[model samples]
Target: MLKPTIISLLMASQLVFSQKKPATTYKYGYNGMELIVKNNKETIIVSTFNSKKAIKDEIALKIYDMYTKKLFVNGDLLTISGNEAKVIGKVSIRKKGNLVLLDFYYDEIQWKTGLVEAYED
Candidate 1:
């Protein structure tokens, strides 16, 4: 009986250690552009880049489409500026007017995605 209990405890410990922790950042590469999202204080910070330059319209649209197909329910992409747009969903993605910030809103505890990048945030 003691041996069985010891085995069960070891197995339980292994399972606990094997589970992945929640991520606070994600990076995605699309058509040569890199999109990054990080949790900052209480807000999510998003940015995009192509080589060394910032990515605009087309790339941002593509990212929105990709995320929509993968994670969100049906939603509309609303243009906010020449460089950005927002996808309305359970978790909304909105572009900041300055062209450098993308605001993401969702309950982190309830949101999960496979696109989370493995790099440090």
Candidate 2:
């Protein structure tokens, strides 16, 4: 009985240590303001001026991250190709900060769907 108990404890510890944490991917868009996300696959309008222009001309974007709750990006802060990126889509929060502190890739796909389409596939 004692031997079996010891083995179970050791196995449990290994399992805990071996498991890896999940990552959070954020999607961002610009409407009147820049919006941040922690997931993907979303649609949004950027700014009132652009929103009134047309659908195809609107801004479409996605942000990928490991773990992030709040994203800080704006015309003065963050821009796409020198131009300002507006937020007009889905935004998700995170529990911890992994992508922010870690060496991860930030894929700014579909900044403007009319110009280019940013998809997972």
Candidate 3:
């Protein structure tokens, strides 16, 4: 009985700590332009390739939400095609008054090909 009770408690805690499911999703031709909806009330989209019309935009997207009382983790999204092998660091994408600033880190890297276009789905 005690073992089952402990298992149930662990499962409940796991659910409480899991990341919230995305309320809505964005399908875009860019790898890092996923529409970020916060509080289910605000939708934020960073311009791809410094332009909202930039299709086939290649980018590097960092995801993290670690935070403390004073320190907030930064999840920066950047487009790689802007430099096309010229810029080895994070690049800025500004368009339609939207800006996605980035900082490059070489400590750890992972490449994915989930490029998409900006649109609600």
Candidate 4:
């Protein structure tokens, strides 16, 4: 009888805790994300005007490391460890006729992907 009550109480506690745990999320758009993740005892922001964009006529990739406070480019599936967090991802750009495609994949925390159908604007 006591064992059964203890088991039920433990299961209830587990359910309550699991239901109350907060979820991490990101605001995805052309303007980029302000705070991609703010959990796991660390914070990671975009820290840039634009993480993915097209300049002139070519696709330019710029990844900002909040930990190092440095900018990287043309990093295909690159990985880096920041002062606060670690980043591993890539942004691929392809041109199909008059339309351009941009695939953005950031990290395990969140992804900032975009599909733009613009030439060079």
Candidate 5:
């Protein structure tokens, strides 16, 4: 009886200490663009972004151009990282009439994709 009780206590301690917690998610949106950050721990964080702008803002246009050049021409995945998080992902661009849409994916699970209305520049 004492041996069985000891074994059960050890098993409970192991179960409590060996479990990993799920990651926390955060999101930010600006001018039809959305950014997501997932933090699994203090050292491991991932980020992804999606943009579907009307080409109205200069900053948005510049970011779109950079992503287009990098993803389409270089065939490379974009890396967006900071002091708190690090993200490596792919960008997909599509055009419908005059509007351009950008979709970013940081894994098979986290991503966003769509189209937006176009505006005269």
Candidate 6:
């Protein structure tokens, strides 16, 4: 009886430890040039890299601009040419006159391609 109870307790403890915590959720900013979202105690690039066209159309675009080193909100749909990438979240960009930003993601293949292309001729 005692052995069985001990084993059950051990199993329950393991179960609790093995369960992963849920990813954290973040709210979109209304009208801002940059925003940051955090998950699991880490800062992942949730959105960045908006183009100029998005601003003209007033459509919400999430982008991470490598040149600016900051996130921006634009007005365009995030597009990935290949099947490896998908939108991780629904991003919103607040409209305020002529300024705009677009949201984008670096999918697994897109990310890998960048690495490979950087070293290629």
Off by over 4 Å in 2: 29-121
Choose 3 or 6, whichever is better by lDDT.
Answer: 6
The residue pairs found clashing in candidate 5 are: none
Q: What RMSD value applies to candidate 2?
A: 16.7
Clashes of 4: 0
Better of 3 and 4 by TM-score: 4
For 10-87, candidate 5 gives per-residue lDDT tens digits of: 999999989754443433222334432223422211122422132113323333546535535323565543232334
Off by over 4 Å in 3: 25-76, 79-121
Question: What lDDT does model 1 reach?
Answer: 0.38
Best by lDDT: 5
Estimate the overall C-alpha local distance difference test score of candidate 4.
0.39
Error of 3 at 112 (Å): 27
Cα error of candidate 3 at position 33, Å: 18
Which residues of candidate 6, in runs, are more than 4 Å off? 29-121
Runs in model 4 deviating more than 4 A are 16-22, 28-81, 88-104, 107-121
What are the lDDT scores of the predictions, listed in order?
0.38, 0.33, 0.33, 0.39, 0.41, 0.35
- All candidates: CA RMSD in angstroms? 13.0, 16.7, 15.5, 14.2, 14.6, 15.9
Model 5 misplaced stretches (Cα beyond 4 Å): 1-65, 68-75, 108-121
Question: Per-residue alpha-carbon lDDT of model 2 for 26-62, expressed as tens digits?
Answer: 4442234333333354323222222222331323232
User: Where in model 1 is the C-alpha error above 4 Å?
Assistant: 25-121
Best by TM-score: 5
Each prediction's total of clashing residue pairs, residues at least 3 apart in sequence or on different chains, is 0, 21, 7, 0, 0, 18
